[model samples]
Target: MSDISSFGATAKGLAKNPIGIIALFIVLIYGFAALTLGFNPKLEFWERVPLVWFLVLFPVAVLALFGWLVSQHHEKLYAPSDFRTDDIFLKKSQISEKREADFQASNEELDRKILEIVNRLSKEQLEPEKIAKQVAKEVKDATTFIVDGRAFLGRPDAVFTYPIAAFETLGALTDEVYFKLSKSVRPFQYGTTWVLRNESTGDVIRTLRMLTATPPGQPLTDIRTLREVGIHPGNTLVVEPPPC
Candidate 1:
């Protein structure tokens, strides 16, 4: 956010910076000299300077080609990321950073919740017999699964189903988290960390240590399956916002 601002604000900020001023001065001088030499190409100085040297120094045609090349590749190989000037995204880039920050905050909240849950399950709730009583009230199956998506102040929850048998390494099989969240009603905000919780026991089952943990872009196999992470069919999972 330190550098995020409109074009006019950016220009004003740069104007106040000494480094920017020096860069601007250099560019202006180069541009002026190039323009002067460009229109007076037939001047007597041309007799002493090689045409190839002049082209290398100026390179107006080269710059035009560069523009054409960018035009051909834009949106395919490249895209505007400017917070304010991106027309391709319909100015969505302007809010892209804010959304990223919001997602980060959401993930932090989930992590906090996960830590609390872990402490409760391991430290506070020391009685395994008490935990058994709680589970006795709720039946758990080892096969079918239900995951409720929670985005925290975002869109409605998206429910997804998964078969325990298919709970293989998401990093190597199917689309990482999608193989689990694929049945969701809405496409979740990508790149958020995910934490799985057992609704019946209020137990924190799994947590994505990083964004790459469940996503397919980077191949990282999970050593533990859902069952290994304390997931069960009767244990309806609440997927908190942020992950893959």
Candidate 2:
């Protein structure tokens, strides 16, 4: 296994160097040509034997000569002191450190945004309607701005329903009317509002009320609340919200 691995690595190294690859190709072609000429039926038995021996030994001799030449100039071809294995490891370490730093910076920014939102909501004089709008806008901006999960990156417009009961409820609320969710459907949190639209006519259907916890299995699918809305599995909830 080790021998095979070593040979593979050697072959890969040789392939990277065009000169080495060309030399190998030449050797193979010449060896095949030599074998063909050596076996010519017109030659006598004794002559054919010597010819075949020459054909076999000539390539071996050439390969030995190449090895000798390479050995003589091995230091010039690859200066051992110039390249260090430790240098490669050090570079890898630096790259890893940079990635970690970038991740921490992103986390800090998200925390700062959350803190700002909390402080705003805590203000005693803010109206309920204004607070609701602010929360919805924040949720929309956060969902669109920071992409994290598989669904966010790939299908940012669609909301997944099965795992979160809130998403299931949202789907129920928007049924029959054409409505869009944010690029991603986050867990229902205070102050967020999801806008729904009419699918066929591209019109505003209705805006979902401020985000609130609803008991699981509660029927949010009120026909009076939604007009001609249909929610089904595997449907892509539009990402772009309807114009105000």
Off by over 4 Å in 1: 1-142, 150-157, 170-176, 179-192, 207-219, 241-244
Instruction: Provide the lowest-lDDT 10-residue window in model 1.
Output: 74-83
- How well does candidate 1 match the true structure in TM-score terms? 0.29
Best candidate according to lDDT: 1
Q: For each predicted model, how many residue pairs clash, with residues at least 3 apart or on different chains? A: 4, 8
TM-score of each: 0.29, 0.21
Residue-wise C-alpha lDDT for candidate 1, range 1-244, written one tens digit per residue: 5554664575565566444544455556666666666677566765536644654665675467557755753323333432235553553433344334544554565466545555566766568786554444332232456777655324465666665445443222224455555555233323343445568887755434343455424433344445445664545767664433
> Which number leads on TM-score?
1
